[model samples]
Target: MYTIHFETLGCKLNQIETESIARFCADAGFGVTMAHSTASQAETAPVLSIVNTCTVTAKAEQKARRIIRMLLAKFPFSAVLVTGCYAQVEKAQIEQIDSRIVVVPGTAKDTLADFPQFFMDLLTKAGAPKTAEEAAALAKDLRAWQPLRQIPAEQTENRLKPNSKDTKAIESINKFRLATDSFMHHSRGSIKIQDGCSNRCAYCRICIARGESVSLAPAEVLKRVRDIESGGQTEVVLTGVNLTLYRGTLQTESGERKMDFADLLEYLLENTDTISFRISSLYPERVDDALCRIIAHKRVRPHFHLSVQSGSNAILKAMHRPYTAETVVAAVENLRKAKDNPFIACDIIAGFPGETDKDFEQTQELCRKCRFTYIHAFPFSPRPGTEAYTMKNQIPQRIAGERVKWLSDFACKSKTEYAKSFEGKTLKAVVEKRETNIGKAVTENFLHIYIEENKQTLKDLAGKEVSVLIKQALDISGKDEETEATAVLVCDGA
Candidate 1:
């Protein structure tokens, strides 16, 4: 059987897409193998490899290029196909890097299901037949075939300049569909309920790459949730580019009902039983009373990741963020009041254009007041085509780095304090990792707990909710710390 290897980089949404592509390949009569598997390491490597890349930042784009180069070196003869944000935004740059690599933009990602047939057509033109023996032998000695050279000029031209039919096919994808039967991660499932973004944050390139926002219908989302629940998935995370912007209309028994993010959550909580749901992220202004009330449901995990790009109102205004510092604080306060010990996290850009020392101090003050569970802090890297890139008074790289370090230190302290607060408290956790004498689980509030238990018991507990008592919270906040010392509840009778 012909084998294919796959690799994914970036967010949970990208992971979901990669798994879907793998399933599509399998349905196309290709056996799947890990990119670094022993089979792939053999003298005859897998004939095909797919890399789903990320371009969230310049660093992310660099990583994608590095991975592509590494894969090329490993599988010299195999066909390499690259897709995702980086490929979408910088198609010419990626194509120039390697002539053999097939570049598919984000708009053409859904068309990945058609890639296997595309590959076969190329092979047939190169004198390879569809018979089992010939296919196997072709895979073994694929280096001699030079698939890239074999590709017809017309086919290459079509890929470079897709006609209106391809455009229409891409535009028609309104609902999120899973091409894979199983998720890459067994402990929890992720469903992309929405895609793209409408927000034009000054420093963001994601909106440019993802295009306008599009939400999946509530009925389709519920159907996917039910299917995941039936598959024994105890938890499902609803992911999207801008989750708060999700809007759709669903036909119910009552009649046609328009559903926003909150309504969708209520519908899922009311209809689904056996599966808990968690949202990927939200905007502070979108966290209305209705959404808070729905989130109070036990099935909705007590974790809220807000896109609070800056705690300083001045900086926020410069970044074109929709909410103010006061708005963000109020949102967190309301969420805390609605749910007990809910994990509140935020995305913070340390330094932006025209940010003064006073602005940085305001951010620190806000961080101290809010007591966030964690903060994803980074020095703002201006991207091409973004307003911030050309804005005046850009902070020096050294100053930005210093600001990031200060914010990171504050975040570590807040996280440590928050985790310590749960010491001796029993929380519901889902097992994610198992070992001979230890295991790791994540609580609904987004705490990572390490439990001391037998491997078999922990393995069996995987994908199931169990009560875990937080015995101790070790201070593992150092930069190089690999595992936090979180002692959890022991199994009864173990």
Candidate 2:
């Protein structure tokens, strides 16, 4: 069996895909292990390392490159496989990094499941020994397979030509990959219901790297959810590239019917029991009254993230985003109406190509009006092929940096206020980490609560759902604080 260690960097979608790939490798008789750092462990070193990368920002790409180089240096004898959006757009550049590094685009990530077997077959054909150690040693000098290197940067579709698989091998893994029982990296379950993106926003390069949007069949989606529920997980986050764009077809006795993200949520809630559903993110324009009603269900977590790039109408138009500032406020209003004190978060790009002082004020005004729980604020990074890259009137880096700081400061204040709202109330949380006398868990509304053991001894609460009473909200400026506040819990045995 080949030993493999996987590293993921990006959105929840990337994380879910990494988990699926790990399961595939393990099921195919490969030894899957978690290698945290460069210092070698007493156990056997992994022979292969796979880095699932991101391309949302130039900083992310730089980080991927740095980490790949570090992994290569750490495991000198192991071969590295780089895949994801970074690999998709910068294939040639990544290929030039090292001969031992194999580059596979995000578009063909599903094919990676078949790669280990294909690799083993190749070694056998070359008269290498069949033992795991012997095969791993022989695999050290492996280079990129020629056929898989045929994907050009311009190709957006699933046009991979791997030498190992037949025409029947080229199917989306969304239809087959189910929720993993053993989560190697996370406490809760993550089910990737969608992949790829069809939208082409001016500042976005993800659509180019990911290609058109595709969703798992609704039946398969239900099966995946059930699989997670059977594993005793309390929560499952339904993730995707553009979650609001998910469109699945369901087979009913009265012929076939279409299901959007809202319909899927309603169906899953009706069919499944006990497990809670958390949506990764939603487009502001798609959060209508019908969707709000579905999210209002008790099974659906009262936390929503909106991909609202900009609040200024002109800046939004420049970014090619569909909705205006009013639409975002309306979405927030609708969500608040559906669920009391819902934790509403948003993504905001502070410095777009043509943002003026008035435009920036509009963004701040929107935040004030909506009173978001949190904000993922970042300065715009021009991607190579994006329309915003060549556009004039780019915001200066100094100005952009300042704007980011302003929005981020506001977000911190907002998050603290939101965390304080649930003080003294008992909420359901899944324990993420446990120490001797203390534990850390996240509440249903996504608030991080630190559990302090009382007279009872602390148990292994990691991955277990328990009731937590919020004692006090911590000061946001604390140095050593790991969670939003300190929580005292009353577990069954404790």
How well is each residue in 277-339 modelled by candidate 1, as lDDT tens digits? 988999999888988898988888999898887878988987879989999889999899889
Q: Model 1 — TM-score against the truth?
A: 0.85
TM-score for every candidate vs. truth? 0.85, 0.88
lDDT of each: 0.73, 0.78
Model 2, 380: alpha-carbon shift in Å? 0.4
User: Backbone clashes in each candidate structure, one number apiece?
Assistant: 0, 0
In model 1, the runs with Cα more than 4 Å from the true position are: 27-44, 116-175, 178-181, 433-438, 480-482, 489-494
At residue 56, give the lDDT of candidate 1.
69
Worst 10 residues of 2 by lDDT: 161-170
Candidate 1: worst-modelled 10 consecutive residues by lDDT: 160-169
How does residue 337 of candidate 2 score in lDDT? 91
